[model samples]
Target: MLPTATGRIERLTLPETDQTVCGRIALVFPRTPVAAAENPPAQDLVRVGEVRRICGAQLRNWGLERFDDSVRLLLSELVTNAIQHGSGSQVGVRLSHTPVEVRIEVRSGPVNTLTARDPGLLDEDGRGLLLVDALADAWGVDDAGWVWCVIATAAHGA
Candidate 1:
């Protein structure tokens, strides 16, 4: 966890604003253990605020700012999937920023499946992979039950 903000919390500005374009919220599904095996994954949920904080910090530290909301949405979706689909509650989230790419990983517990009908255009649920496919440069699930996706700055740099 990040050190608690000591004084006045800082607010950040987006690079630019245009509805047609999403700034880009990227994620990397964590693989290593987030905590001890005896704990539940929910105990280690990656909160939205935390994700935003982490992403923003990484971007700024890497000399950038204002990630697209798609990054946040996908992070929440994939992390939620890890907790909802997997057994462990101590899920992990990692973010990396390179001049040409951003990668996210979330590792929860082993799972049973990763495929199903994509959510309908207006359905309330079941569209994680579909959303990832639509927004991410590419995404897929692994045999070990981990899921991940990467959205590059321009294309295949990730």
Candidate 2:
């Protein structure tokens, strides 16, 4: 009835035939590498594009194309922030789906602070988390230094 991480199968028995059928329900999660902060800026840009493409494809596979624009924008902002502020060498991106929503996570090196702030009108920097707050149903940084956001599935009124 419930899916487990260890990939367990459930069996159902039919009384009339005295037969049993076994089946497993599994959720497939896709992880894509967005970029390496150590890489050249141009290369990082290319990696960001690849991450966007992969996310689009994954969302389409789930029949959630309507969320593509929001996903793309939020993911891009997260990746950019990781590349710019994170301390580690590489940025990793992951997309997972549940009954209610789709979650996107970006992991990089440690961050000095997780707080989001408003930027002055003429300022060219900052505002990444602002966009995320406005678009994502929920967003936050985990203890392991991964930044994650959830977007409601189309069926859930996203």
For candidate 1, write residues 35-65 as lDDT tens digits.
3344334433545456666776666665545
Q: What is the C-alpha lDDT of each candidate?
A: 0.56, 0.65
> What's the TM-score of each model vs. the native?
0.59, 0.71
Number of backbone-clashing residue pairs for each candidate, in the order shown: 18, 0
RMSD of each: 10.0, 10.6
lDDT of 1 at 56: 63
lDDT of 2 by residue, 26-57 (tens): 22112223444344455555656667777787
Give the number of the best model, judged by lDDT.
Answer: 2
